[model samples]
Target chain A: MTIRTTLSAGLAAMSLTATLGASTALADPVTVGLITTLSGGGAGLGVDIRDGFQLALSMSGSDAIHLVVEDDAQRPEQAVQIADRMIQSERAQILTGIVWSNLAMAVVPSATAQDVIYVSPNAGPSQLAGAGCTPNYFNAAYQNDTMHEASGAYANVLGYENTFIMAPNYPAGIDALTGFKRYFEGSLAGELFTQLGQTDFAAEIAQIRASGADSIFIFEPGGMGISFMRQYAQSGIDLPIISAAFSFSQDVLPAVGDSALGVINTAEWSPDMDNAANQAFVAGFQEAYGRLPSVYAAQAFDSANLILSALAAADINDLPAFRTAMRAADFDSVRGAFRFGNNQHPIQNYYAREVVSVDGVLTNRMVGTAFEDHQDVYATDCAME
Target chain B: MTAALFLEQVLNGLQLGLMLFLMSAGLTLVFGVMGLINLAHGSLYMIGAFFCAAAAAASGNFWLGLIAGTAAAAAAGALIEVTVLRRLYDRDHLDQVLATFALILVLSELTKIGFGPFPLFLDVPPILSGTVNLGIAHYPLYRLALIGFGLAVALGLWLLIARTRLGIRIRAGENDREMIAALGVNIRALYTLVFALGAGLAGLAGALVGAVQSVQVGMGEPVLILAFVVIVIGGIGSIKGAMVGALMVGVIDTMGRFLLPRLFGHFMEQSQAAGIGAALASMLIYVLMAAVLVIRPKGLFPAHA
Candidate 1:
């Protein structure tokens, strides 16, 4: 299995670098390493992110950048090792493409400490936005709590009095609930946390049926969400559910089928958004990949554009100029207007999306904006000193 | 907390145990009869789920899909037994492990190629979709039916292995493989039959559970791990042990997650209770397995002994 994955990754890297190797007019090639989970439970997320970034790379048509992609297998230790290899052997000046927060936490701090610019396409852990922020680190995506906080705000809008909030028993899960509580005005009937990647939610379903909660907010991601939604629907629990986009996105909607209908989730981007950049991206992505892009894809595409624009603005030898150009956010983001906050995270809008049948398939449709021109609350904690 | 809730939980435990039993029974049978460690068993489970989901979508009949799924898994198992597994029979357990592990990768990749890298949906049949009022609490009719079906299969398996001539041959074969061969029994054919039967059971479990879980690649590995634990606790190579061990693991796991937090809540803050309780609940099964191993290293029912 390891050999097959390594061989495929090597082939992909070779093909990409071979194309860029032709543009040898530049003095020193700017190498970028993408370390993301690509072989395990949530591999779909990484695959989408990689595809989106690669789409951007091909579109940029620049021969100056050399891309090296590797799978971290969703392990923190593995991510750290990949980051080290990317820095030491690959000599990559820019790093991106981590899908999980735990992996980001392990890779970002250490990689940035060594002067490599870490552009996160997904997974904006709270620490990276707060006191632990660094000048070398930039989150082109929304903060980790953006969706959960938006869910909380939307739950208040929907007037759910007594809510039950549940998440996996991990740091990200705690951050999710904390963000939800920050805006939710209603009383919580119960709070629960299950094991990460738990396939069965039978006991948890029983508790939800009995909790008397008017609604539920769940943050189980990837396969965990699929299992929870299926079992929850099977258990005949019809309580209204609000959730983060991590669980209810387009990538997971098909697997869940009718079980996810009427469920609402929060996200920073949707494929149906109206804008020139977004329209081009959606059409190009669909034409190239034959599938609608997820929010993860959109964020990754934007991260790639941000890097490309920075590269266009400054030469590789000038570090200060490159950082300044990146901060300018001069690229046309798929999500209309975009800017970086003091903490290097995006200041963008969060939308409340309901799972609706689009073209005979389950997908999310934007209903309303939860946070317009939203920025992470932790931006104040970042000093950049 | 209430008797009704406890009853519902018990029913849920039974459903889970039965599912595990379906997977473990086949695993133990294959191990006992062949002495070959087959990690690709989970791949068979995945195949069953994928076939069931595809057939259900194509035919729009869940029952037909279930049959097709089980039959396909059996066919696949028999094919592997004849072509690949037969070679590993004489090899050491380590060789068997490596070869079977490689098979898992091959099967999973092939499934991904055939089905695409997306999860397929399988709906519960209409007849079992609704709820049943179990005196104090309402439960899903499908879950209740699943429990009944699993128990029936267990009984049928017991009868097949205990009453029939094939059962006698199987028992004798487990005791002494060479003696059975010298007695003019077609040991090769028997091994293939046993392996196919086991694969079919695993497939049935996958098809049954697919309705309640997303049918996707690698979905079988977690259930496979739990089934291993069940066999170890029940005493490996013993059908009855698999049943008992599955139920014990199921009930303990369910009750632990449901009750541990409440138990802790009585003495501490709710948040603290929830955190610590969930942590302990996740480890409860491993703790039970350790206790079982300490008491009976051969498991609760060693078929050979």
Candidate 2:
């Protein structure tokens, strides 16, 4: 995997200087512009995405592809600027590698409007799944609410009578709580929304201790997750924490350590998941990156493979053929048995994962399937042709 | 809220304040003595955390890691002062700001290279890992220790500034750099020492806090912002002001988060209340800062006055 990545890096470097007309000699080389949060708070997720995407490209040994990567810095305006540059200057036919829902909302509309194929590896905002869905856009990841919704259902399965749900006060956070409440059969003991990038959780912890909630479902991802889990553990509150995989995946669990042990999270993929595509992606990612692949990496690997399969079927310059090929979703996904809904979002299974101490290191292992072949509820609202 | 819960919240506020104090002390001192707006102060805090996490993991001893982290940060601070900052002592604040901001980017990237993009865990030492019975609420022993340690540092700092020769020199240097230099004090050495001292405080705070939070890249920027607020509210050059400002900011922030939602819940739906409450809670500190600015433009405890 490392050797392949190195070779791809060499190819990518060579392509940087390679003129537009140079690649047209054989066939029109597809330029994929990947704009994601490569710096700031949630950089780990973006890094994983890029690595996963590159790994798949390298493994496929595709020469008819040119990858252009840029950092969005987790800002909407910056993402817009990058999207414009990629579309107008880089002549990228397909745009991917958006990590956050808000940034995706900002860039996807404009990119798809201009006839660029927007394939999302992550950040499946509900709007895109519903009324905002476009024929030019395909979400290789699950909808924004799917994981949280599944976790809420799993909480019911665990017989939780009263659960406290908390998330940051952003669009994603609102979606998280709304999703959790949709399938959560239990009475909500409390609903809390914290400041984005908030590092302290003492006040919230104190409140949760008093609220008498049987379970806590928190959607604080990345650094926020690390702080909350550590503080929650320090607070000596032992309530079961059911979470979305954004906070509990391999990217975050190492930092969360023992505090996150025994916690359950819901996601579309895990490293230890049993499947051929998943096994290859996980092993390849580990060998390349020397770390366990998070679900972000798994989804990104799938996205790249989707692109490859689509490219194999049709030329990127031919919009109708490319769209049809992409719609077919011929790629073998790490999540297994994947297909796109009418809305172009994934119809995939969500799994329950438990954070356990494996060989003295914190990692998530698949516990059970939460929702089988779960198609997002918002897909019905999409009127895309 | 129950008395125990309130007490715990207050303690949490103090713990937060003390952590801010550690960060602000270095920044305030640097500004007061050198008239430099060093934005890279947060990078030093991050350096401490990464060092602490790495050392702790390598040594399997938290104490050794803490010492190493603090010392490394101080050394790095001293090195930067000698190499880069000494040249900027005579430059304007804007130049200092730009240079320091660049330093922040460099340090953050370098730290990311040394440590991977992922966060590192710093476990709470076994002795500080349990809970203490506070009658109505059980508080974490680790947090209590953090507050206690911060207080000790504050007292020690007060003594160092008020009682020690170096402290007197620092204060004197703050008052009149030319006079101190004319009086035979090596201004360059004093500046280096003070810079190193400030870095050590920031580093110590980072090491302590890293146990409670994940040690990751860009961890220091938020704390650095709060520390700036601390110094601004406290009066930039004053240690007493930093302490007061930190406590005030900490309590207000914490209590706002805890009480605001409940306050809004009386008038609206829970979800709406949560959304509005959280929005207001985040803005509470800045509102306090604005109010304070309106009342006293120079801050509550001006070091000079």
Candidate 3:
């Protein structure tokens, strides 16, 4: 995989320089560096993002953008190193496709400080969304807390008075619980900070059973979520669960299987959203990849289109004009009515989605609107010069 | 905590301990008999899970998948023992570590190539799906089944070591490898058999636990770390120590996670207590290991003594 990525990147760079030599002024080729987790535990998310981004580029049939993809393997140091190499050696103007927040935190600030355009397909850490927000940074995805906040709001709508909340002990986990509490006007029956990557949840389940909570709000992403959901189902507690879509995303739904059926999750987009852009995206992704695209993929697809939109409106050589074009977000987002807030993070609708079997495949369907036209709270803190 | 909740946590601890025993038993045995440190033991566990999940998905029967998983792991164990580990047996600890570590990487990548990047689904069988009333607390039947299976395996292992000719030979081999080989025993074949047995046990644990957890490429590494701690606390190369240490580690870890936060909740805010408690709970097992080592340098039940 590494070899193929390097070879493809080399080919793209060669073609880019060849095109530059041929034409002096019109349609300058822009280089995009995609640094994501392509190996280890978190590979599924990165694979989806890469495939989604590639699919969008292909569907547009535009050769003006040359993408150089590298695997960070979910390591913060590796992401930082890749960002440096892409910036200094590869001369990649736009950097994108980091999956985890820790990696994003490591790479984004420095990348943007170097005057490189940093477009986030996912992993919108609160630091970047607030006081640290830079003019060179644009997040095509919702801020990290948006889905958790949406879950909190949806829980209120469902009339849950007491909810047991649990998250892994990490920066993002803290953010998740804090995000939920910001919008949730209810009593917390129990709050748990489980070990990150700790698979067993028997003790936690026992506590939940004894806590007498009306509902559960969990923020365990990836394998942790898969383990928790399966064990929780077998525990037979019968408490309704509310969570962000990270746990119920299409990348993991098959592994989670029937355990996630009918569970309510909140996200910016679902495969079943009733929009022309979303329908086309879902259909196009299925045709291209032979599977359903997760929220990560939707974000990456939007990120690619956002770049494409900017490229069409302005030249990359003019940094100021290109930055303005990106801020305008003049593209049809997979999630309808997408636009950038003051922080350059998306201000969009958050929807409640339910896991349902579609033709024997486990996927999410749109249930209801959790929050309409929701802008992140951190936008006010962002003072982009 | 209520008495029922405490009892449930105890049961959870026992279940976790037994799974660790299954993993550590094999690891300790290989270390005792051959003096070979096999870091790729976790790879065998991962292989077992992948095989089990794939077989279960293909055959549509959990039992068949379990059997296939165990057998596949045993075969892979034997193959590796013959091809790669045979060379490292005569090398020093560092060489063995390096070789086995490489084996882990190779095995993980191969599994990924075979199974793809996504985690596989492996559910509990219908017979063991729901919760069972345990007089005080309702516990998941599948977990109870796992505890029972662990106990059964432990009993079977004890009986094999104490009562069988192979067991006698194994004990003798552990005492003196040269003497056993001089006494007309095929030591190479015996080594292969023991390695396969250990691999099979690890694989069994992997298949059992994979039903509840995510069955992915690196699932075994975390458990492998705990298993190492179990063996260290129990005494290296001692199955008896593995059992006692596993139980102690399991119970203390679970209870710490269950009680520590609440203990702090008396003086501090709930969320602060939870964060501090969880941080402490994660380190509880290691602290226990260190304490055990200070008190009993040879572990609770050293094989040689």
Q: Evaluated on chain B only, what is the TM-score of candidate 1?
A: 0.98
lDDT of 2 at B67: 92
> Native contacts retained by model 1, as a fraction?
0.56
lDDT (10s digit) by residue, model 1, range A1-385: 7999999999999988987865652556689999886665567788889989988888778766788999887899999998999999988999999998888998999899988999999999999999998888999988998879999999988999999989999999889998999999999888888997688888888988888899999999888899899888878778999998988876788889888999989998877788989988988888999888888888889999999999999975578889999999999999888999989888999999888988797778889889999988898899963
Chain A TM-score for predicted structure 3: 0.93
Give the candidates in order of TM-score, highest first: 3, 2, 1
Measured on C-alpha atoms, candidate 1 has an lDDT of 0.89
lDDT of each: 0.89, 0.90, 0.93
The residue ranges of model 2 lying beyond 4 angstroms of the native Cα positions read A1-28
Which candidate leads in lDDT?
3
CAPRI-style grade of the A/B interface in model 3: high
- Tens-place lDDT per residue, model 3, B1-305, is 79999999999999999999999999999999989899999988988988999999999999988998899889999999999999988789999999999998888888988899889999999999999998988999999999999999999999998899999988988999999999999999999999999999999999999999999878888999999999999999998999999899889989999999999999999989989999999999999999998999988888787
**Tens-digit lDDT string for candidate 1 (B1-305):** 67867888898888899999999999999999889888889888988988999999999999998998899889899999999999999999999999999988788778877887667889899989978887788998988999999999999999999999999988888889999999999999999999999999999999989888878778888888899899999988999999999999999999999999889989997767888889999999899999999999989998777
Model 2, A1-385: lDDT tens per residue? 7999999999988887686556553376789999987776578999999999999999888876789999997899999999999999888889999999989999999899999999999999988999989999999988999999999889988889899999999999999999999999999989999998888899999899888899999999889999999999888888999999999988988888887888999999888878988888878887888888888888889999999999999877779998999999998888878998899998888999999887886788989888988988998899974
Residue B100 lDDT in model 1? 93
1 versus 3: better lDDT goes to: 3
lDDT of 2 by residue, B107-222 (tens): 88788778877898899888899799978779999999999999999999999999999999999999999999999999999999999999999999999999988798899999
Which pairs of residues collide in model 2? Answer: none
Candidate 3 similarity to native, TM-score: 0.95
